[model samples]
Target: MYCVQCEQSNKGGCAVKVGSCGKTAPVADMQDVLLRIMQGVSAYASLAAQKGARDAEVDAFTPHAWFTTLTNVNFDADRFTALIAQALDMRAKAKACAVAAGADLSDLPEPATWNPGTTASELAAAAPFAAIQRFMDRDGPSIVGLRNLVLYGLKGTAAYAEHARVLGHEEAAVSAEFHRIAAFLATDPTDVSALLAQSLAIGALNLKVMELLDAANTTRFGHPEVTMVRMTPVQGKAILVSGHDMGDLEVILRQTAGLGINVYTHGELLPANAYPGLKRYSHLVGNYGGAWQDQQRDFDAFPGAIIMTSNCLINPEIKSYADRLFTTGPVGWGGIPHLTGHDFRPAIARALELEGFTQDAPEQRIPAGFARNTVMGVADTLLDLIGKGEVKNLFLIGGCDGARPGRNYFHDLALATPKDSLVLTLGCGKFRFNREDMGDIQGIPRVLDMGQCNDAFSAIQVAVAVAGALGCGVNDLPLHYAISWFEQKATAVLLTMLHLGIKKIHLGPTLPQFLTPEVLGVLVDEFDIRPTGDVADDLARMLKAA
Candidate 1:
């Protein structure tokens, strides 16, 4: 019943009783078991791959198992327990294949029980365990915090990788690496250099995973284009699609075609409007709400069935509309129906079954017509403005948004950026400034809305392209990063930036609780990473540096 993989831990530094994200003890225990099974699968797959087995088939299930355990993704203990069993079965099948091929496979351990409802402490008290409890019992905060950070980042990467797979883009190497890391976590590896290398490797591989997803999305949906989306409700029985999976949204849009149900984007799905293929649906309406943190209130008022496609799912409070909430693709909440296996028939059925609004109501609309392809398509005009000295700089100001009050800093920073500078944003953090009227410079929109957090890949691509066009290094370009992080995907993006040598970025809404002073100091000294301060002062410093 101890969990240390998320921001909200209990008083004992783990979710010993109930998870902060509303996961019960049985669910947490099942997730841990699932992770262990994923490692076994990974270990077997790695051995198979080394023994000249087909790389694609060796251990492809590892990432899917790992992703199922991410925070806010799965709360169903029964489903998780079944998944652990499935992974164990997969491992056994792979091991048998290796043995049948005359490969030496004597070192593998017998498959452990995948049963749920047991704590690590209880398992430690029992016999014949691998002493996983001993590592969990370590008392030092520094060691435990570092372990949690690494595990959490892996969990986030697993989720993103799974979404990529759903779109038929499989990077076998990334899944293989994920399984390798999961196995490494199971062992008591004390090599600091090896652990550090693994941490950076996770970041580096996440870059490839995200690139695969980007290709999957853009190739399927066409590169995102600039198009204004109305926030107003359309006349019909409508369903709202939230979170970041455009693949799921596309499926639902296709399924609900001619069914008389209007589909609206919500949260990270708001960026779907920027994709030409997705935007072509006449019944596909505008974005419905703000960021994930604001969902309780937003969902409460909306008069339609809601489909959550990914993370940031909070526990449902109202029993009346509880049946109306549907989740899929690594997003789960207790008591909510989850659609599985690339089929959203359940969600579509629920949307139709529930009496959704039949008429359009007067609703608000905001202009969110910016994504990488759309913005880059206008790069020629932007270059013209820059060459004319009308545009001064570009500030990439976005990340995860939380309920914390200090998040106002991001809104203020976006507002405070010089009039001559453009504010580029992605993820829910853009909600703070997406609605603001930051007038364009020539033909370039000042507040450029890139896609979701994963779409940070797009931001990096834009930066590198701008650097090339300007005949300068990315760091030498008039670009500054003022990022606000609230979760692990942000962690991966920050690491990717560091891997690219992007420096002097301002980060805030509080640094990760897992970062020790020594580690924080290393980042500050090496990367010039700093916490956000007064908007005016931070702006002055960035502008002065430019």
Candidate 2:
């Protein structure tokens, strides 16, 4: 199996037995087959779309199915087997739609026509020849690397699009782009310029997805506002909701509203405390734990039920908390109870049966809810401070947090910023030093928590507003970025930054293993993307540049 779509790929690339994220060779192979089948479905779907015959179910399924192939989302081979069959059936329906519309289908690729059997074993056997890497033989490393960039970016975009879809938000153009890219990859073209254009196009598509999600979240929950969330546990039966799904979290909060169970946010859900509609619940206590990578230790020590709503679910730690663990939406495992149709009663019952916090822990608090609206609310204040030179440098430091070493660089860099500068953080990466006492510059807090990684939209809004107020391009503003990434969502966000002409981003922990030197050189030369260096050195360089 060969998978380098994530930062944690084993020994640079998972080219041998299994993936570093605990994905078995069989599961990885099955995932590859599923992706190939998805391309076939897309092949027909795109043709059907061209002929003005569109299927909403087929359009929605494209992102939902693609989302399951993302890193650490699904590990169950049986699940992939079922999805493969579904894709095959969908392909037939799409083909019928295209033929009825009088679209020609004679010149399709193997993925658009071949059926690799029904069983898991059959799919695994076909994986080697069917995988995207098969194009490396004809396309070479640089082109293959660029193709993978587009592929991973699409996976990230699909994940966000699925989240938006769950909330009754859908754009026909976004769905069309998914089918467009899927059909593009099916052909395995070797033109480097075309592939690069596709990469940036994915970035542009992702911006739309993020905007849709931002609207979905804000419209449903109201814009996030400043709120102090209790970091310590309170005495009660508890349920912790993790991952990036606010809709699932809201459903859980509703069903458990009058049941005397306390619903707590964990991981990316930490920002839920700041949303007006969600925080209005009296029993939705506070955030627990730090990041997804620390869940093994955190969940084991927790005294209540847990439900993972989205990505970053690992396999090795399930046995430690499997009896109390549940999954919903696209997140799945072989044994975990999968909640469907937003019925979370089983999870709530489990939480009721388990003992929660026996007594209130010592009180501690951290702030959240500084999304786009909140930041812009204080824009005049921010700009006035910048003009007065009270705030000289603005540092945006955050992304996905992983268990791998060297992440302490972000922790150290966040602490090393000048007191006059403000630190803007989002995603799980903020757990590194979010609790630190950075005080405030004038009346503005030094560290601003800008919702989840899903809230990168908010960060982008803040950047653009600040730059426009200063009468300069975003790249010319006195702002610096230190981005830490672990998965494809971060890949999509990085591409969005590049797409906006934001330059000189310091990205690290490690560069993506899928990026060959030639491709990395292009990013470095074109966008001035830098691999992070020593904390002091990078900090000094950023300050010097400012």
Candidate 3:
């Protein structure tokens, strides 16, 4: 099995023997089969939609299928078996409908019917390991790379779409586009122009999905507010919830309330402190660690159960603590138990079983609780400061944080920002500058935390408001976007910026492996996108450009 959908691909290429993320050959093969089944399901769903069938049914299945195929979301063979079976069944049903309507179709075998029995040897023997091999043999590297890129991007979009679905905001068009791309991936390799159009369409549809999620989060949680959160460990039996899903965090917080189990935000969940609805939970403790990359070390020390809600899950090395790790909502791996059907009771019970610390450790505090609503509440004051020239410039510097050494660029750039400027950050990337004593300017915090990666929506909202108040387009505002992206959500956000014509944004530590030179050219020409260099030089260039 060959896998190259993430940063840690074996030797910076495909993971042929075992996944860099700790997936075995059989699991990787099953994942590939699951992906093929999903594509088949998408093809059938797209055809159904075109033929005037019910769109909601198609929408319900589209995003979760893509979400399940994301980098580290699902490794559980049982879960994957069920999902593949469901997709193949859907495909078969759609084919039957098409036939009744007098349409002839290729008779493809159903993917779900292939059963991988419980035993490792039996599962390996039963799974379709050869199918993916044949497909890869038939496809060129460029075609395979593009398909992987689009598939990964869809995974990211599906994650956000699923989050929004939990909050009751549905966009049928976004779902349709996902199905469209999935269907496209199944077809024979197309011309470059057609593929390019489909690639851009992924970007376009992603914007709608992000918007829907942004709306769902802000509307349900109340706009995030600028508030300080302690990093100190509180005394009690507690559970750590990581990844980007606030809905899951909220539910976990609610369920753990009377159970004597405290809940602490980890990774992307660090931003949950900004939301009024989530923050009001008395038992909701502060953030415990930095980014997703540090989890192996961080999780080792923490005695409580850890629940991963989304991407960037690196498999743990300690096999003894396997039962202590719980995952839900698009995050999974082989041998790890996942919370199914939105039921987190198992996670809470595990937290209780492990018990927590008997006493609180010395408390440490860091400012959190900055999101779009929080920023906008003080917008008038910010505008007034800008009008009087008290605030010189604004820097929107945040994105995914990784193990890369160059990520120090964010800290250096934040440090280099003039004292008169305000720095806005979100996601784990903020950990770089969040610890810095940036100080306040006229009662407004110099460094504003805008929640998780999806909360880049909050940053966009603040940018638009600030620009409107300053009587200029968003590009004309004294703001620059220097973002570090690790996954597909970042891809979707960058596309949204392009869709809105926001220009002169800087991205790093390196560009996506999936971006063709020609596609990169389109971004450079259309959005004035550039890669990050020396922080001092970049700052000078951005100021000069402004």
Candidate 4:
């Protein structure tokens, strides 16, 4: 199997008997088939749309299904098998509807025509396209890599949209762009120029997806405000909610509300403490972990039920926390019982049975929830400090966290930033040094977190506003972006940054494996994207700009 979509690329030939992400050959092959099936769905769905026969189910599945194929998301072979079958049925229905509405279907590719057989064995042999490497090799690296950028970026966009969809918010524009792009990838276009345009188009569309998610999150739970979340343990029967899903947290919180179970936010869910609607529940305690990569130790030590609501679920091989693990939403595992339709009773029961912390641990707190609204509220103070020559610069550092090394560079850079600069952070990357006492620049805290990766939207808003107030473009302002990415959400956020013409982005711990030299060149030439160097060097370079 060959998969070079993340930073763990092996010269774009990442062929292994087993994937580095722990996907076996059979599972990787099925995943390819699954993606191909969606291409077929895209083809038929596009045709169906011309006939005004759009399917909301398939539209929603566009992102939901794509997100499952992301790195470290879904590895259950059986789940992929079931998903492929359902995809075939969905494509057939879409095709039937489009044709009945007088739409032509003759131009669709083999993905739209091939039949994935009834079982897993048949699927491995029945894949219609050549191996991913071979097919991508037919075109130069630039063409293939550019197309992949759009594919991964759109996958990220869809994941964000899916989160909003669960909260009863759906944007038709996002669905249309996802279908259009999926079909575009299905054709395997060789024109790098066209692919570049499509990449930017996906970026523009992602901006909308981010905006929609912002509205969904803020409207549902209220805009995140300044809140101090405890970093230590609170003694009680506990449930740790992780991932980027608020709806999942809300449901389980509602179930365990009157009960003695205390729900502590973990990983990306830490921002839940800032929302008035969620914080209204008195039992929703504090945060307990750092990044998703550190969860094995945290979960192992935790004494209550653990909920895997979304991506970054623990590998059954590396650690066996699945015994006490319960999953919901799009994330799942082979042995873990997934909560269906918000029925979290089993998880709650498991939480009650487990003995939590014996007593309150030492109290330590870290501040967060400084979202767009919160930052904007303090804009006058921040800008006034800036004008007074006290707050000299702004350093925006954040993105996904991974087990990959060099992430300590993030820790060093944050610690190295001058006290006069405002250090804004988002995503799980902040866990590197978020608890550090950076103190405050004037009255503004040195490390102002804008919530999760989804809150990158808030960071963008603050950037634009800061630029506008300074009478310059974002790239022209005394602001910079140093981002570390692990998955597609970071990809989508990068695209949005490019869409806004933000430049000189310092990205690390590694560049995407899918980016061939040619594709990386385009980013360097057009966007001035650079990889991080030594912590002192990058820190000095960031200061040099100031």
Candidate 5:
């Protein structure tokens, strides 16, 4: 068992005994098995989709399955053990569709040919047969790394696509592209040039995924308005919603409308408070806690039920509150209660039963949801300020946050930015410095929170708009990127940034472990991707790049 997919990978040793993210060796191996078998399913699904055969269940399940294996999404060995059987069923359905279209099945890999046992114990044994580590030959780390890079990007796209799908939005093109890349990886293509092309194609696909999510969120709830959200907990029966899913949060808000429960946004969901449709609710309160990494203590102190709607879930520290830890959609832990439908009675009931804060916490608030429309609404005024030399540069400093010492660099970087320079942030990484006051540049806020990581579309939209007004390409604008990455979702965001011709991105807490020196060298040469050094040095370096 070996796993080093995230930024917090081991220094001198392999994670054969246990993953740095608290995943057991057996669970890590099973996740690999799940990913390998997914490629097998995709091999058939890709061919079937080509023949004008489409299955909504199969299309949606592909993303759902991929997202489950992401770090911290699911650590229950039994869940993967159960998912393997479901994979066999999906594979059989996809195979039948391919056979009906007379697609060639003979060249399919062993994963496509091998069938898992029906019993749980037998299924557990068969997972080892699908391990991905067997294909890592050191001779071609660049090739293997690029292939896996595409796979990781696909995983991130799957998560974004699933978020959109849950909101009753499904794009066949997104699903088809995902299956296409998964199947291509199964063939083990080793050509460096071709693999590089496929990797960028995944980036293009991610762009579409983010667009769909943007439409889904904005269309369902009105375009996010720039609003201030109170940080202090309101005195009442409270429930905190975290992660990136706006769909579930809407449903939960509706279900608990008149139940005397005050819903508070936490982590990435902090942006939800800016949506007019969401903020209209009477019981909808302010945000609580910091980012996903700090959930152990945050979730412990909160005296109410917790709803983890998506990824960035940590195992709860409070044993008593663990009962209140509820999982929904793609997120799941071993013993947590999961909500299958929009009905969140258990979470609501728990909130009613638990004793919320006896008194109102101190008054504090933060700004969020500077989504494209809201940012652009005031774009003319901001543009005037930029033209007058009041607004100098724009810095985007946000992505996944990790439990590492170097992460504090993000916190300090925000503080070091000149008041004349506007700072834009999204994703959980903003938690490091979000609470600190950067104040406002003129009437515009100095630091803008642009929603979740999936809302990279908003950042892209703002960049394109700025470039259009300035009569230059996005790369030619005064904007510089210091994006942090922890998982595949961040990988997809990086690929999209590169695809848009944006360069000189400083990525840290640490670089991905999957990239070999050769692969890392290729990115450094082609895209100018650099690992972040000292906060002051990196900030000066990025400012100089503009």
Candidate 6:
């Protein structure tokens, strides 16, 4: 097995017995096999869609299949086996539709026509044919790395598209583009320039997905308002909802209503408190945890049932709370109780039986809801401060956080920013220093917490708005990007930044292992991207440039 899809990959790639994310060789290899089947499924699906033979179920499953393969989402090898079979079935249905539509399939690649015997051992044997390391051995590092770059971006795009689809928002064009790219991968294109262009195209595709998610969230929940969320726990039977799916959380809130259970937000769901539709629930209490990386300790301490709505799941082998841990949506572990169709009665029953917080803790709260609309509502104030030179710099520092080393740099960097500058943060990375008091710039809070990682769209909108008001391009503004990447979503966001021609951005704590030096050089040459250095040095440098 070989996997370098996350920042915490073992050494350069997980080519041994287990991945750093706890994915075993069997599970990892099977995931590759599932993706291989999906490529064939997509090859036919894309052509079928072009011939007006689209299948809605196949279209939806395409994104769902890709999203399941993302880091920390699913680890059950049996789950991947089921998905592989499902992909083959979908492939047959799509191929028949294309054939009926008079589309040609003679020139299709192996992914579109290969027949692996239907058995676990047979699928395991086929895994080697799909292994990415084999691609690296066949085609050199540069070409393979660029293709993986595009593949990872597609994974991120699929995640966002799944979120949007659950909210009743989707576009056929988006799904068609995803299949087109997957079919392209089936051919094993090796042209570096063409591969690089496709990588950027994936960036543009992810931007559309992010936009769809933003619209879905805002439309369903109303624009996030500036509100203070309690950090202290309230005494009651409780269920903690982690991950980034508000649609799932809303369902839980409805199901558990009047059941004397307190629903707390964890990780990226911390921002849900500011949404009017969600916050209107009196039983919906406070945020209890920091980020996804800290979930083991957090879940162990919380005296309630836990529901993971999406990715960022880790193994529960060492935890006693695994019994009470529930999986929903695309998140799953080998033995955890997987909930479906928004029915969370089992989790609710467990929460009622368990002992929740015994007493009301000391009241503490933090501000959230500074999404694009909220920020733009106060744009005149921000613009006036910028014109007067009171706001010296705008530091956009946030992305996925991990337990890996060198992450302390983000915490230190946020604290080191000048008092005159505005620090904008989103994603789980803010959990590092978000609790610290950064005070305020005039009437504006010095630290602004935008929504989740998908809300990187909100950040981009804010930057472009600021730049337009200043009569300059986004790069011409005094905005310094110090992004921290942990998984493919971060990869997709980075590509979006490059696609926008945003330059001189800093990324860390370590670069992706998949990128060869030559490909990295190409990105650096074109975008002026740099690795994160000393916090004090980066602070001084960004402030000086401002």
Candidate number of the best lDDT:
6
Off by over 4 Å in 4: 8-15, 127-130, 317-320
What is the C-alpha lDDT profile of model 4 across 62-158, one tens digit per residue?
Answer: 7778778777677788888888888888888878867877888778876788777858668878653524655654677667677778878877887
For all predicted structures, in order, the TM-scores are: 0.90, 0.98, 0.89, 0.96, 0.96, 0.98
Q: Over the stretch 1-546, how does candidate 5's per-residue lDDT look in tens digits?
A: 766677765542357777666777777777777787788889998898888776677787888989998877887777788887788788888889889887877788766777766565665686566655566764366676777788788888888888888888888877888888888888878888877888888889999999998999889899988788899987888899988888788889999988888999888888889998888897888899988888888898899999989888876644457978898887877888888877799999999999988889888988887999989999898888888989889899999888877888888888898889999998989988888878887778898999879889999999999889988998887787888788889989988988887888889877888878888898899999889889889888877876
Query: What does candidate 1's lDDT look like per residue over 176-284, in tens digits?
Result: 6776676576554555556656667777878888898899888898887777778778776779888778888988899889998899988888888878899889889
- Superposed model 1: Cα runs more than 4 Å off: 2-4, 8-15, 54-58, 97-139, 341-346, 353-355
lDDT of each: 0.74, 0.88, 0.75, 0.82, 0.84, 0.89
Model 6: how far residue 505 lies from native, Å: 1.1
Q: Compose the digit string of candidate 6's lDDT tens values, residues 1-546.
A: 888898888844554689877888988888888888888988998888788777788888888888898999998877888888888998998898789888888789788987765688998888888887777777999988898998898888899999999999899888888888888888888998888898888888888989999999999999999999998899888999998899999999999999999999999899999999999999999899899989999999999999999999888878889999999988878999999999999999999999999999999999999999999999999999999999978999889999888999999999888899999998999999889999998878998999789999999999999999999999989999999988999998998888888998889998888899999999999999888989988888787777
Residue 429, model 2: lDDT of 94
Which of the two candidates, 3 or 6, achieves a greater TM-score against the reference? 6
Q: Could you give the candidate ranking by lDDT, starting with the highest?
A: 6, 2, 5, 4, 3, 1
Error at 33, model 4, angstroms: 1.0
| Rank by TM-score (best first) | 6, 2, 5, 4, 1, 3
Clashing pairs in 3: 73-331, 73-332, 75-332, 75-333, 75-334, 225-369, 237-356
- Backbone N/Cα/C clashes per model: 1, 0, 7, 0, 0, 0
* Residue 388 alpha-carbon offset, candidate 2, angstroms: 0.9
Per-model RMSD to reference = 3.3, 1.3, 3.5, 1.8, 1.7, 1.1
